[model samples]
Structures are given as C-alpha cells and as structure tokens.
Target: MSLLIVGATGTLGRQIARRALDEGHQVRCLVRSSKRAAFLKEWGAQLVPGDLCDPASLPPALEGVTAIIDAATARPTDSLSIRQVDWQGKVALIQAAKAAGVERFIFLSILDAEKYPQVPLMEIKRCTELFLAESGLNYTILRPCGFMQGLIGQYAVPILDKQAVWVTQQSAPIAYMDTQDVAKFAVRALSVPETEKNSFPIVGTKAWTAEEIIRLCERLSGQEAKVTRLPMNLLRTARRVARFFQWGWNLADRLAFAEVLATDKPLNASMETVYPVFGLNPEETTTLEAYLQDYFSRILKKLKELDYQATKTKNQKKKTSLRF
Candidate 1:
C-alpha cells in the first residue's frame, strides 16, 4: 500500500516519511517543489509536486495513494493565515482525498486544540478536525503535545550557550514528546486496526516545568543558567505594537503561544492509554534530559568542527603571506 505524506518537508513530516520508508512501506511526498524535497527523493519517496493552498494542485498528489498523513502547516511568516492552511487547505485536501477514493486519512493536530479555541492556531486545528471527521473517509487524528525539539531549541540551547532562558510567566509542567516518537505513532496508526476513526493524544512519560528544565540544564551542562520572566502586560503591548506595524511575521501567533505557556495548564494526556494502542512502552519515549544531551552534544560537535576549519584557514593564509 502506498502512503502520501503531506507537508513532507516539515520536521515532523520528514520524520514520518523516513519512518514509513524504513518500515518498507512505499512512501510518496506531496511537496510544492521536488527540488526542495530532493532529500525525500534520495530516501526513495515518490515526489508529487503540489500546493495545499491551491485546490487544483491536489488531485495529482492524491492519485493512487491509499492513505494520506496530513502534516502540512502554514508558516507564521507567510501571507497565509491559519484559516487558509490549517482549515481551508486541509478541507481541500480531505475533499480531494475522498474524491480520489483514498481509504484512510490521518491528521496531525495540536494537543488540547478544542479546549483552547481562543488561540488562533488551536482554533484552526479544531475546525480542521471537524471537517476531517465529516469527510466520510476512515480517519485517525493524532494530537501530539509540544515537541521536545521546540523546547530544546527555545529553552535548553540558550542555557547551554550560557544565555538566559526567557519566559512570559512561570509555566506548568509540560510533557514534551519527541517528534520521532510521534512519527512512530503516526506510522503505526495507519496499520493498526483499532486506531481507525479515533483520536489519540500522544505525549511523553514525564512532565517538566520551566524551573525544572533550567535546573536540569545546569546539572547536565555544569553551567549556571539564568531565567528571565517577562510580564504578561509587556507581552501584550509588544504584540499590539507588532500588529500595528504589520510586522514581517505573525506576532499574534507568538503571543498566543506565549499565552499558552504562561497559563498554568497541563499540555499532556495520559500516556498509559496511548502506548498500548501502538504496542509501545512508556520507557521507550524520549525524556527531556535525553533530548537535551543529544542536542547540546550536536551543538558542541558543530562548534568544534568550525574551530578546526578556522584554524586550518588561518594556517593557509599565513603560509601565503610568508611566500609574498
């Protein structure tokens, strides 16, 4: 059976494609350009060039595909709004997929999307979920929590680099799941009979707060890390100023994300119920510490390589100057 992975160029989408390919499944990618998705082609993924925003471009991408994993998302910097890509685009894809006689349609949504309708991103996701449910195709919705990659990049990396981790407010504990783990669950959902027509909240085993994360960073990196908290009023003012200027990107999205973090709420669901459906164990999920370690290790390796290159370049310049 062939699978079509929408948003095949995204971080999560790419991971899903790689996982499906490794499992010996025939994978196809619906990409805007085959040039940008050359890596997917190298991984043996059939590339179908199309755009989610353009409905006319979808049918060709959905052709001959048995299932579709909808992971496409709108860029905050793009002229496209959340309504366009998250809702309209997805609805268009669902319609196209249904007409194409696709059997299963899998959607990647945000965790607690319905509960936080005030947030534009969540509202868009909620609407898309509804549209997919009524699309008459066998559907599975996977709502994953905040990714470990996101937290590591936003919070942990700064600490490792001896910079402060900034926050709008003290956040509650969040169970940040690894994108790889979520990808594994998504691929399993396509084949698992019990997962059909159901929505699963996928998350990691442990929950962590901003303070705990900072402390962990100090422990792991052996460096004193500072935490800077910004007031909600200040954030709101900044958002307003950004909106007035018609900024390069969507500042409202950033503010909404910050609001979600500031409000003390649990972003994770019980993993006990989720792991069994995919025949996965809690221990198998990547933890915050594990993610931090791997992330910093890579950063250090890259810095070392840069240093070596700089030193080699200096030696070459010195030799040339001496000859002159």
Candidate 2:
C-alpha cells in the first residue's frame, strides 16, 4: 500500500517525493543507486534498486505498490539514450503497472508534446501518453510547462556573476511552475477520483519571456547582465550538424528543445478548469517575480556576510603585522 515514485532523484521527482511524504503517504523510491539517493532515504522513502532500462526490475518494484508517480525521463546527462529510456523504458513500466493492477498512475509529461513531432522528447512523450491511455490502468497525465527552479541557473546565477545569459532571438514566453506546486496536484490526484483518466495543464499564473526574466534578475541583483542572444537560424544549423553523427543523436535530441523556444506561440495553457478539480487555488502558485526576489535576497545576504568576514580577517592581519 505504498505510493511508489519513479525517478525520485530528479529535480521534479525529489519535490514529488517530499510532498507525498509530508502528506503522510507511504513512499517508496525506485532508483538505480541507493547510495547516491541517500538524501531520499533520509527523507523517509523506502529505496528499491531499480532501473527503467532494465525491464526485469519493474515487476518486483511494483509489488505491493498501489499508486505510481512516474516523473522519470531521459535527461541530457543520463548514460541511457532517449530511445532506450523515455520510449522503450516507459513502455515496460506501463505494462508492469497494468499487470500489477495499480489503482492510479500519475504521469508527468510536457506541454504541446503532440504538436512537435520533430522534437525527440516531445514525440516520445506523446506516444507514451497514447500508450498509457490504452493500457487499462486508471491514469492522470499532468502536462507542465517549465520549472521555475531552472531559471536560477539559466538566468539568476549568470546575471549575479556578470556572465553571459544565453537566450534565443525568437524567444517565446513560458509559464513555468514551481515543481512543488506541480507535486501538490500529483499527490492530490490519488484521492480525487475526478482527476482519473484525465489530463491537466499545471502551470504558473503568468507567462514570462526570457527578456522579462533577464530584466527582473538585473533589478533584483542590482547588476548589469551580460546577455547573449543566439539566432534561431544558428541554433537550427548547430542541430543539423549535431545530427550528422550517430554518436551525436543525444545532443541533437536535446537541441530539439530550441524549436519550442523559437516560436511566437506562448508555452502556456489555461488552468481555469483545472483548479476546481484539484481544490488548489491559483493564488497559491508561486510567481516568478516573488521566486526571484526571495532567491536574490538570500544570495545577496550570504554574499555580504562572506565579504564582511574577509575584510575583518584582512584588517586583523594588518593590525597583527603592524604590532609585530
């Protein structure tokens, strides 16, 4: 009677695990390395050694598990390929869930995955969604835009460090949600029968373009940002060159995300219909501005503390030397 979380070590997965645990769910984490996932163990999730790439591991992992939160995906840094993990691996997982007779399956997918067949991840996700629908298991597919946590590295850090913040010339606004917010919907899906066999777009209240984010960072950090814009044509050419080699398909697959950003359409979906079902208020979602403000305040305060300590140490050395 445990709620199993696949990809428990991932950014979104970690948040989901925490939310489930906080809400008093019996949590189990399927991970490749239990040692590396010690933090999750510390957070009170039962760790089971399992890998999606190894289909044999699925059956045993699914034993006694009533619900599943599938947040696993083929990351760019993963040793496995998108075809191996995202596509084939997910297929094995779905079949296992159906056989195990899990009560509810919560899948985390991307927004507009069906619209972009050219992107490998998007294409794979769309195919998986169709497969899951036909798998005979009650499922809820949560399609979210981007994660606001990623902006810390993509914009906030580089701006605070006075380094180049790379952006696309044809940038589209994206409504990014905090992973924690998305996690709330995922855990709530288990008890909410209305969410079963349905799909919902879980996104932030407002859509923000890259330019607006850069300006916000500049204002918050009080630092002039070094912005570098990559032309869409150049990005396409880079992707083309990357696809020329068999070994580069992974890189090419990752570059395919550029297509989503290099468009006029916003990467947002209406959440008006979604809020009432999950009993979640729109105001509870974290805004990008507030997220950035809190991050800068904490970071700047730490930086000031470090600077003061360094100056104090230097002054103490000078006094000691003068006396000597």
Candidate 3:
C-alpha cells in the first residue's frame, strides 16, 4: 500500500511514517521542506513536496496514493486561517484523494471537540471531523487524549521553570498518550480491518492530574519543585496580561485550562481496549521522579548557557556611573 502522510515532519506524523514503513508499506511524506524531508528520507520514506493550503502542490503527491493521513497543523507561516487549513484544506484533500482513487482517510481529531468550544483549535478539529464523515470516503477517526509532547512543545515554560506553576483552575486528571503509541495505533487502524471507519480513543496508561505531573517532574529531577494552583481570577487576569504583551493565546484556551483544572472529566478510554486491538501493552510510565529527571536535565543545559552569558556581561561591566 502507498500511504501519503501530510505533516510528515511533525512528531506524530514522523512516528506514523516509521510504523507504516515497518509494516512493509511504501510511505511518502508530504513535507514543506527538503531539509525537513531529509530525516524522513533517512528513515526510508519518499518525500512528496507539498503544502495544505496550496492545492496545486498536493495533486502530484496524491497521484497513485492509496491512503492519506491528514496531519497538517496550522502554523504561523500559514497564510490561510485555521478554518482554511482544518476545514477547507481537509475538504480539498478529501476531494483530491477521491479523484486519485484513494481508499482510506485517517483523521486525527481531539476529544470532545464540540464540548471544548472555547478553544478554536478544538473547534477546528471538530469541524474537520464532520467534513470527513460526510465525504463518503472510508475514514478512521482517532480522538487522542492530551499529548505528552504538549508538555515539551506548548507548555514548555512551566516544565522548564524551577517551580512548575501553571495558571490552571485545579489539577484535573487527564489521560495523556505518548506520540509513539498514537503512531502505532494509527498504523494498526490503517492496516487492520476492524478499525476502518471506526472512531477510537488513545490515552495514557493511567489518568494523571496536573499536580501529579508536577510531582513526577520533581521526582524525576530530584529537585523540590512546587505545584501552585493559581486562582481562576488571577489566571484570567494573567491571560489578559499575556494577550496585552502580544501573546497569541486565545481567551477560549485560557477558559479551557480553567475548566480542566476545576472539573474532573475522568476520560473514558482504557489500555485494555487498545492492547487487544493494536497488540500493544502499556509500559510503566515515568512517575513524578522520572519525569523531573529528564525535564531538568534538558532544562539545566539551556540554563547553563544563559548563566554563562550573564556572567560574561557582568565581567565586562567594570565602568562605574560618573554621576556625582
């Protein structure tokens, strides 16, 4: 089978490519850069140069492809709106795939896309999911829980800081998944008959709270880091301040953070279901101790460079103020 993976350079997309290749499928990556495609090339994937918003660039890649995994994310470089990428681009891809005689459409959706209306990201994903279901194409929807990578990617600030303090409402337990698991599951869904046109949820081994994640970091780092829950009013105020400083975070994202913190939406997916369907057994994930170790190890390396630069500046600041 020939599979075209959009967003092939991304974390999840890369993992999907690896798994697909291991399963003896010819994998073609749709990447925006030849440089980014190099790694995929090294991993034995053929690069199909393309972008989501540019339909003219995509048709060449879609030719002779059997399936498509629409993993394209909206980035700052995108001239199109989120609607254009998530909805309009998705619709276009479906039409192109149909024209190319593609068999399956694998969509990456979020949990409760409708319930989380405050965040435009979630809303966009939900909108795309709707388009896929109605497109008359065979589709498999994988609604993953929060990604563990988000800890490093989106929420890197708190994870890097000495004290991991987030302005969340309260520590709400969530079922997060490693991107590796998501990739494996994606491969299974693409190859296995049972998962076609089915909606499956992939999550962590166990549900963990934000506070627990902080504790895990502390344990991992072997450092005493506090998890302080900020007041909702203060969080809202801080978000406003953040926005004033040209931070592009939406108000809805802030509210969603609040909702997760305040409420207990114990997500309803189990490893039991995932193991049998995908032949995957959950691993003993890092508790607070292990996470902090890896987190701080990387953080300290960056901090050391900053400290060295600061010291160099101070050493050069010998001239005294001449004001009498």
Candidate 4:
C-alpha cells in the first residue's frame, strides 16, 4: 500500500519516510517546494508540491494515497497561528484524505495536549485530535514527548559552549524520546491493523530533569556546565515586555511553555500500557546518557575544527605582519 507523509522534509517526517521506504512501501511526500525535498526523491519518495496552509494544495497531495502520516507543524513565522495549522489545515487534510478514499490517518500530536490546554500549541493539538476522532475516518493519534534531538540543540549545545542552561523556578523532569523511535512507532501504526481508532502516548523509558541533563552533558564533554534558574515571575514579566514591543515571534507562547516545563508535571502518560500494544519494549528506546555521549562527541569534533581554522587564520596574519 502507498503512504503519503505530510511534513516529509521535517526531522521526524524524514525519519518516518525513511523507515516506511525501508519496509518496501511506496512513499509520497507532501512538501512546499519540490526542490527543498529533492533529497527525498533520491530516497525513492514521489514528491508532491503543496502547502498545508493552503486547502487547495492538499487534494492533489492526497490523491490515490492509501494512508497518511501527518507530521506537519506550524512555524513561528507562519502567517497562521498554531490553531490554523493544527486545526484548520489538519481538518482540510482530513477532508481531502477522506474524499480521496484514504483509509488510515496517523496524526503526530504532543503528549499531554489535553492536560495543558493553557499552552497554545498543546491546545491546538487537542482540538485537532478531537477533529480527527470525529472525522469518520480510520485514525491513530500518536502523542510523543519532546525529542532528544531538540534537547541537544536547546540544552546540550549551550552547555557545551560553556554557557548557562536556563530553567524556570521549578524545573520538571521530562521524558524526551528519540524522533527515530517515534517514527518507528508511526510506521508501525501505519502497517498494524489493530492500531486503527486508537491513541498512544509515546515516551522514553526515563524522565530527565534539566539539571540532570546538564550534568550528563558535563560528564560526557568533560567540562563543567553552568545552570541559570529564573524565577517564574521574571519569565512572565519578560514575556509581557516582549508582547508590549510586538516581538517578531510569539514570546508569550514560549514563556508559557517554559512555565509548563517548570512544573513537576509529567510530560507524557505511562508508556507501559502503550508499548505492549505496539509490540515494543520500553527498554529499546535510547537513553539520555547514550544520546548525550554521541551528541557531545560531534560537538567536540566541531569545536576542534573551528579551533583549527582560527589558529590557521592567526598564523597567516602573523606571517603577513612579519613580511610587512
């Protein structure tokens, strides 16, 4: 059966496409630009040029696809808000998919979306989940926690650069799963018949606090990392200031998320119940330590390259000065 992967150029979407292709499935990718998604073509994906924001662009993308895995996300710079993309765009896609006779629709949602309705992103995800459930189409909602790849860029890089990793007043532990693992589950959902009309909360085996993660980075990099704990009130104040200035992006949403992260709330539901349903072992997921070690090694290699370039430039300048 053929599968259409929305957001095929994104990190998680690419992983899903790769996994599906490896399993010998015919894969079609919905991308805004065929040129940006050219690499997907090399991976044997049929590229369909379309934008999620544009309802008119979706029917052609969904045509003749047996199933769909929607990993598309709204960017901060997009003309539409998260509500528009997650609700309106997704609804449009669902309507088109049903019209195209697509059987299965797998949606990638944020974990605890219902619990954190105050957060705009999660609120929109919850709304989309409801819409998908009532769409009269076969659907599977996979709510995955934050990705380790994102954490590496957000927390690990700052720690590696000898900069402080910031946290709110009450930092909570989060179950950050690898996107590849999430993709694996998504692909399995597409192939597995029993997963239809079900929702699964995907998470890693362990929950990691910001402090614990920072220390792990330090241990892996052999460098001491600093931590900065900001008061909740301060973050709220900063968010207000940003809103007053009409910042380019939504700082309020970001600050709201930061506050959510500060609480000791569980980011995801128990994986124990969902894993067996998917025929997965919780222990199979990547651990924080393993992810950090690999990430720190890459960071070290990059730092060495930068240092070499700087030294070479300095030596060249020294030689030129001596000649003068």
TM-score of each: 0.90, 0.98, 0.78, 0.89
Q: What is candidate 2's lDDT per residue for 174-248, written digit by digit as tens?
A: 999989998999999988999999999988989999999999999999999999999888888988997797667
* Backbone collisions counted per model: 0, 0, 9, 0
Off by over 4 Å in 3: 75-80, 153-164, 226-262, 283-324
| Candidate 4 backbone collisions, by pair | none
lDDT of 4 by residue, 1-324 (tens): 889999888879999999999989999999888888999999999998887789999888777889999999876565555666767788899889888989999999988888877777788889888988998999999988788888877687787787888777686788888888998899999767779999988888788887787778778888887778889889878777766644423546656677678668867567777877788777778887888788888879998999999999999999999999
lDDT of each: 0.84, 0.92, 0.72, 0.84
Error of 2 at 239 (Å): 1.9
Q: Output the lDDT of residue 221, model 2.
A: 97
**Model 3, residue 83: C-alpha shift (Å):** 2.0
Pick the TM-score winner: 2
Instruction: Output the lDDT of residue 29, model 2.
Output: 97
What lDDT would candidate 2 get against the real structure? 0.92
Writing each residue's lDDT as its tens digit, candidate 1 over 1-324 gives 799999889979999999999998899999888888999999999998888899999998877899999888987776766667877888889999999999998899988888877788888898889888887999999998778877776776787677878976758678888889989999999889899999999877777887888888778776788788888888877777776655423656657766677678878788777788888777878888888888777877888899999999999999999999
Span of ten consecutive residues with least summed lDDT in model 3:
245-254
lDDT of 3 by residue, 58-102 (tens): 789998999988667665444455666776777788888877888
Q: What's the residue-level lDDT of 26 in candidate 1?
A: 94
